[model samples]
Target: MSALIDRDEFPLLARAPELVYLDSAATTQKPRAVLDALRAYYEHDNANPHRGAYALSARATERYRAARERIARFFGLADADCAIFTRGTTEALNLVAASWGRANVGAGDEIVVSGAEHHANFVPWQQLALERGARFRICELAPDGRIDLDQLRAMLGPRTKVVAFHHVSNVLGTINPVREIAELAHGVGALAVCDGAQGAPHLPVAFDQLGVDFYALSGHKMLGPMGIGVLLGRREVLERMPPYMMGGDMIEFVHDDRSTWNVLPHKLEAGTPNVGDAVGLAAAAELLDAIGMDRVRAHEQALVRTAYERLSAIEGVHVYGPAPDARSGVVSFTVGDVHPHDLATILDARQVCIRAGHHCAQPLMRRLGVAATARASFYVYNDESDIDALVAGVRTAKELFGHATV
Candidate 1:
């Protein structure tokens, strides 16, 4: 299948036609629609939300609310209040760890996470466990770079307070069975936390149906602007947790000694909201919804599989993760004796962009017995030509590195 949208739709890619952007896993190329939405927000509704009494401020507040509602509906969330605007997945996970984990987790309790988690997901929980005297249990990955379900099941018990894992592995592109993981956590009476920074962009996500207590996603990875993300939590769970922050609009009443908190989202969001970014993200969600995620997923899979096959056929190349059918559009690999940074530099020389280093997955890197790996990830604006450029650049890098990979 062809890509649902092409480079022409992305201003950056359209201007640099020769540049092959395979780093969507880090951040996607923003569509013109998203950029337009952002510009429109600033031009028309540029004001502080919630606290302002003026007309422009009122419009900004309404835009923020409407954006939240639209994004909630996009992700199958029934109540927009349950979706908290966050700086990014990092901040969202930290909020859960700081508020929910702090309140609920205790001594001897277990917090289970997979080896494949990004640092944002892994570190907060680990730190929480350490601070609370809880057991930070890590479920190591299977040989295929996915979390071992059997291992996870054994890790969960009555003492388990949380079972946190990634919906998609940023390093290996393995798509974990989120529903099954959530079910296993629920069986042990634990809350399921999902690091959905990667999965939400390439897959059709229904937050309510995914059976997770908290799901976090980044806007920049899904054709939206940076500085915007969402943490979709169950309403009941959110109500029980204390406010993650205080000040700004997240207040009901204030006194000299004590203060009452605001309701739902405002209770969690403590500062002036990023109305422009939220508007951009809502436009991105609408664009994706119109194009249909089913088609987007299929197109990405096709591109990644092509890259996987071509890369694997090279004698010195080693591809990580499960088969193409079992993962998203990310492909992490290494060429014999060629450092990932060096390979990335070579690729850059050819106007092909790919992510290098540990890919922010240092634990998984250690588990896979590597210091770093080169990653090529895709999105709707990516197509076969990008894959072709990537393969060619990689082949060139192998030759330059004295590997003769072909």
Candidate 2:
């Protein structure tokens, strides 16, 4: 596996050769390809894109436009103009809520969201409903941490203007039925929006096949640079919505009295733009395509399965989420009486990185009856050795906390 794609491609992994990184659900380590792309862009193509006619500016403009086209194709969106770049998933969700939600949703309208959503997907809609006097409804999670489709169906009504959810839960790693959810939302004349931050990194997503109105994803979680994300919406939907942010790039005409917004995507993306990181994100997408998303999903699935089995085998450890096939590449678990933070600290001492917190899904945490749980998420770079190291670290935590037996 290392021969296929060397771990040394990531500078941090090459430097700390012994680091077992298990927190990819937060952010992934970038490959050299992405790094070189960013550096090369700034070194050779540094200029304000789409605003100048000079040679350097034209080159930069082409690079920026190509990056958008590349990312749109990578996500299976045919019309590249529909892909809107933003800071990350949070900003993308806020864009939809602030622009589309505010325009379409009024008093007595309804917006439905799942219980397993990250704060990015949850807060914006909740606040949107509050501001619009619309009803904000949360669908409950199944016992296995998957979204309860039945409950969601019951929540949909004539007044439902939007239904938002995560394609995969950041904490539980549940892979949602996005196509079905989209269909359900459409059944009631509601637009379906998905938070694909976790999904795009681990699974193959076809926008047309899924039939969703809007999908949001972050670049940093998929081996790309930070401060970049994609908001994909249907062409008509994007064209119909108002501008998310008002500023320089997103304008078609400006006057002392009034201004007209730009095209489909540019109207959503405001300001100078993160041109270099956008180029880096395009490079990352190319690398992932070369690896084949199916293989990536398989690799993470195997690691997650091993992690679930080994972690759950511990004397008093409890793992959350559904069966191995039902979830993504994350495993959230609690050890005996040890706090998640303590367990994470012990693992960090062993040079193993893991995430420990409510994972920005405090509602799900409340449902699970725990303040937080230690999470170990896998990616293409992880292998069996990493999982073994994590299991050993958990056992060490039990021993240090005086709960080890046998």
Best by lDDT: 1
lDDT of each: 0.93, 0.91
Residue 144 accuracy (lDDT) in model 2? 74
Candidate 2, residue 386: how far the Cα is off, in Å: 0.7
Candidate 1: misplaced stretches above 4 Å? Answer: 404-406
TM-scores, one per candidate: 0.98, 0.98
lDDT of 1: 0.93
TM-score of predicted structure 2: 0.98
Q: Write the per-residue lDDT of candidate 1 for residues 52-103, one digit (tens) a residue.
A: 7899899999999999999999999998899999999999999999999999
In model 2, where is the ten-residue run with the lowest total lDDT? 1-10
| lDDT, candidate 1, at 320 | 90
